[model samples]
Target: MKSFKRKAKIYLPLLMVGAVIGLLFTNCSKQGFDAAVAEIQKGDDPFLGYAWHINNTGQSVFATSGSGVVGFDLNMLKAWTSGLSGSGLKIVVSDDGIQDAHEDLKDNFLYGVSINYHLSTPTGANNAPPNSVDDNHGTAVAGLIAAVGGNGVGTKGIAYKSKLIAYNLLSSNVAQLDERIGQQVTGGYDIYNMSWGSSQNNLPVPVAVWGTSLVAGVTNGRAGKGSIYVKSAGNDFIVKCHNSTTTYCVGNANFDPDNNMPYTLMTGALNSMGEVASYSSPGANLWVSSFGGEFGDDYPAMITTDRSGCSAGYAQTLNSGKVEFERGSDGNSKCNYTTTFNGTSAAAPVLAGAIALILEANPNLTWRDVKYILAKTAVQVSPNMSNVTRHPFYNYPGDASKNVRLPTGAIWENAWVTNAAGFKFHNWFGFGRVNVDAAVALARNYSSPYTAGPSVIGFLMNSSPSPNAIPDYDAAGISSTLSVGTSLRIEAVQVQINISHNNIADLGIELISPSGTKSMIVNMRNSLTGIAGFDNDIFLSNAFFHERSNGTWTLKVYDGASNDITGTLNSWGVKIIGTP
Candidate 1:
């Protein structure tokens, strides 16, 4: 569970439980090595059969109560046989400290390159290790990224041979947060996996400095080819509306302002059945999704390396009130592994490992090229999701007089939008779950003109109207348009909004591209329920990827609730970031 904070200052040092994995195929067997590619050696890794994320065949992932859908996997066996195992790449697990001595990770853990921060030394230092029993998230994260393969003891990682490093920035104080960001840049690593995120409330979180750092990483890091940054979309799909409300509310991935940036890949989580993981935060910023599974006891979850012994990690021998899998039983008597590690936290690392394989296939490909490849090859899962609208506080028994009702005929969430570029995108699954084999095949022959350098041309087109009054409880909300003239093959779209409302969560925001593609940027009845309105806050959407940025972009703001709260759209604008 991620620690939630509501403070004036920002501190992102907490763990958020989130969502991927897979191992060997029982029937899809290959004999010996291929002639052209490197030898496909899975070694004697004993638990390979239990890794469904690597190759799914309806296996239960070590749980007896549930089963996964066949063919809902990363499809890595083909890529692995073709010699794309992410060798010679450095991946940084930017979360809690990693157990460098863990048997599955020691061979690949890059010594003296990882950093750990303490109050005594705010600048951070080498020798990163778990600070306490609570600091155990990164070890599981590392195992998912590049736990050593073959040596034959535990489960294998997605990129089993890739170099691994860690940064214990979550344990650092808020005073050194800037130093932590700087450290993220100082390390010349190829990919950074951030499996944690801040709260889901909408209180206008600042991102100017963070965006600057992300730009620096993609522009100057990794010898100018650009380092890839993968982040979790969040895991707060079902949460309390507020401190006082008992009803559960939906958490949008866009609530966290950091996820809206174009420089990082925001990933969502899916279950073993190829469905949206129940807790995955949905939003328009998600680039792709991966299996994060469910709790490992009754349902299938992730299988990864835990703390070395029973008494230290999630799987303890003597632990009481825990499931059989987490208590050193059910073929895990040695207490060396855990099957309950699921979340977007799990999903981010899984995607990171896939990115490592992509880089290995074509190291010359730029970050933008990698993103484009993913967008091109992603597979859309659960294609039947429909448009949804919510009315959380409607006819509240506690305060019926202050009842809330969503405006009629207003869609709070869009089903699936196929842009003019022929790319399909969904808020729950992004472009779709990652297809490792397809992505690798594309990477082998992929090249982008943007590889010379990032020509991320950004232009803002603001609305001419000063302020438009919004109607209360009306589906016909204020509509503003920004006619973009710059010719850019759009990669990401950001909408800067300035509004004043008593309950911003009651406001549903939508962006319509000139190509007639509609994206719900902010869902109604979100975590921002009781807050005032936006003040130049920026919202992002990846649904417009590869579209032409040369037409009118419409922005619609709806007062979805009947709470008698009036608001005004002070000013709004569109900022397009992409290559010309």
Candidate 2:
């Protein structure tokens, strides 16, 4: 383990001075303008200009003073000014296209590294110009992670000093995504931020082909250490739907399986108040949460760079249904910026920026090392009893509610689970929100558990084939058990289930370890109405982190829907991968 005493010695003075400056600025409310000007003159960060979440104390003074923003309490900006900025790291944003020429993003842009895969013959250069309708999304995402800081211009980025490479992979073509992943691996990019995914209710199940390609990329990317993939959990939780004639809402975040892979770091969104964003997805796959503001009369969304002229973003749409261009002091049309960027799209980049800082603090840390430090240091917040429910679609009556019961008299609580060895986890918020100070500190001293030898040799522990039929609308369905013969420190758990049903979304699968810790592998995706059930589809979970592999592990497959949708547990198996 790294020495905390040595780390404290280097950063204590900087933290103390920053706190004093923060307090001084906080007390002199009237001099806020003068303080900002002085900071600009001293080449300090000017994030306080438009970022209201920094000091948002209440709804009344939201844009002025509060402790709710993502990086405020963590002192991430102070770390940036103290020379922990991502100077040598490379970050790539795989999205529609980025406006590399935006005043806030131009300086850190990596020339010749960007590619436009959307073109007929995918070119090497990023020719997607600014002010186009499709250019704003990537530009905003890039700005959150690598927009230039302390430049006396627009808002600052998380790792403003990091180099950015933009790839225009606009299509959902699996080949295009695989090609981009290949480029990131071969091109030596350290981190890849993906803030977009498939739309809600559209193929609400995981695609096996996509999952295989993603696993390969992450396992072999970054010259063997593996490139860090930061992905958004999605924004489908806000949609409302009904089964047949019953009314219900779709908040089961598990519907979007693109982020359920083990190698990727899945990020969810939190509002300024540190509460889960209404639209952010929830599931066991979520690894961490970050600030992606709420949209309403009281809550404001994220503020980032936008395309120039009068042809970009929601600001233009809100301005009399046309793109409206803001003019500078020189009376010339200028690039527009908006505070309407919300959802997991904005949250993923926030974590990516923080990851750059971690890499900058300790470049030797591996991809798994980063995940470990994040899981260990993330701060738990907002312990509401919302997650403890019968089912995600608990509002619906009849078939949905009959099979979605939790035992007989059991009540669910959104509680934090700390394993025997001390790793923490939460379903809705993952390991809670990211704490830059703690993550960076841990990263600096992190010693990889697999460093003693080659990466921990992962072997399949046991497998149980279930050929039994699962009854429809039955709370007590078919289960298979696998007994472990050897003791092992579990890291990743892979479950493959095969079933045949009209609506696979009505199935809820759970993995009960020998210790009785239940992991919801597949939740009831009400939006998925396809007849194709889980046909040898693999689902990975790290929720069982730090558990001892012994005794009999149970796999329960319950069919939660009625109305002629029935399935058989054709065959199910579990692969335990870890060190012994």
Candidate 3:
């Protein structure tokens, strides 16, 4: 089934039962875990005394009792902690900077290894400036992954014992990003979590130089086993705001090129209701979803460590410049913790923590193996109702004169595609919500597909090329085909397109595999109004995961705009990577 145009929503009746049972077991196990954690001495960590997300026992010391409405299912965590707490695994947070000296984080910090790439004389120290506004971001991200657990002080991280290395790349340029990533990979870090990116719909498409660097890192890093890179799918979502009678619109996620990189595990965000977060970006590029909380008073946000001194952090904003604190019976601020961390930023680290657990369970698994296991074991959550509307600036030729109204009904439903091998995939929720327990168990007993022999090694199995003119203002676009004679298990597909146009943002591109699985390479990016067009830019897609590579593959390019600006498809090609 074509992903975008379909209305198939797979609703699992068993999920409701499973959620109920999961909650019951979580509550029952909380008491034991609580007592176990209380025995450890936590110097000043207040939230760990009674955090709802960590304990799930309705005994939170804070004002908001999130109970069951604001936490990742702790059953998985409880099961994971029983056997492992990521004892030896390492995760590097590449962001603004991490407050390594924060009480909750000092224990797990890997000093002398973290680096500040933006510095002229890059140092091992990765702590943010003492009182900088941007310093809290990395601190919050680090706390989510490896803040010390059972300390009786602060909240516990997903993998509280995992070692953390911070790399400050906030002010570094694109070239520096690759350089620092290289350092992490070579430093034996098991996983890297990047929770920041340029705005998804911003103008001027990014070049593929950084993408090439990422490909090289995955191919050569970690002693050739490859380092795991977990990235946050952008938070840009096309929303309509009606002020009185006038309406203002925004951008979509399909244009986020960073998430489209196949080498990284791009994650989206889910709220307390297990639904897509209002700001979480959506597209075929999303690999998975994780709990990152939601907006509004009814839905509690995620709670994590903030910058020291409470000078700049999420809680400060909530309390009107004062640090958010747990109130005692006397109505006085007692323990300090911030419950304002949200967005895909928070979701990425959650997934990174899960990866740390997986690595701790089975460190021998290759990077691809981790991806395979995550795709296999994720819990398929409910569908996210989406509305696909025409770009306001570039309506289809025939519909140019019609008034553009907000789209209604569900235009995109998260549907499952069961491949011949029984592997299920989805464009929206990815394989689904992360299940740490299931993933850990699977990892302990998993075997790599590439371990069999050379026959299973991923290689370029086929290719098709085309250099022709693409039709503008026409639904019937240009197409090029490539034929494969031998059957092969497909792992990834790469498409390269070169074009020249007055306004390249008006273009829409797609690729159809031999099995008729259509992957949308580029949706009309109305936000990119630059006159420059694509020049041999490469786009990657995993939509046809596991499909046999032995048929005619077609690349289609078209411009849906009726405006004076038009473009010609200079050249296009398809490369299928897999084992024969």
lDDT of 2 at 74: 35
Candidate 1 lDDT over 465-559, as tens digits, reads: 44488888888888888777777888898888888898887788999999999998887767776778888787789999988888888888888
* lDDT of residue 373 for candidate 2: 83
Write the number of the candidate with greater TM-score, choosing between 2 and 3: 2
lDDT of 2 by residue, 245-275 (tens): 2333344444545655677888888766556
Candidate 2 local lDDT, residue 230: 88
* Model 3 lDDT tens row, 33-140: 355346422455555544334433332223232323333443355544467777888888877677777778899988777766555666566543323553467788
lDDT of the candidates, in the order given:
0.76, 0.61, 0.60
* Ranked candidates, highest lDDT first: 1, 2, 3
In candidate 1, stretches whose alpha carbon ends up further than 4 angstroms from where it belongs are 1-41, 119-124, 172-176, 242-247, 320-322, 389-405, 449-467
Using TM-score as the measure, the top candidate is 1
Q: Once model 3 is optimally superposed onto the true structure by TM-score, how far is the C-alpha of residue 309 displaced, in angstroms?
A: 2.4
Clashes of each: 12, 6, 4
Q: What is the lDDT of residue 566 in candidate 1?
A: 86
**Alpha carbon lDDT at 423, candidate 1:** 94
- The parts of candidate 3 lying over 4 Å away from their true place are 1-75, 118-120, 126-131, 171-186, 202-216, 239-257, 296-298, 321-336, 383-416, 419-421, 452-479, 485-487, 530-532, 558-566
Q: What's model 1's overall lDDT?
A: 0.76
The superposed Cα distance between candidate 2 and the true structure at residue 516, in angstroms, equals 2.7
Model 2 CA lDDT for position 357: 92
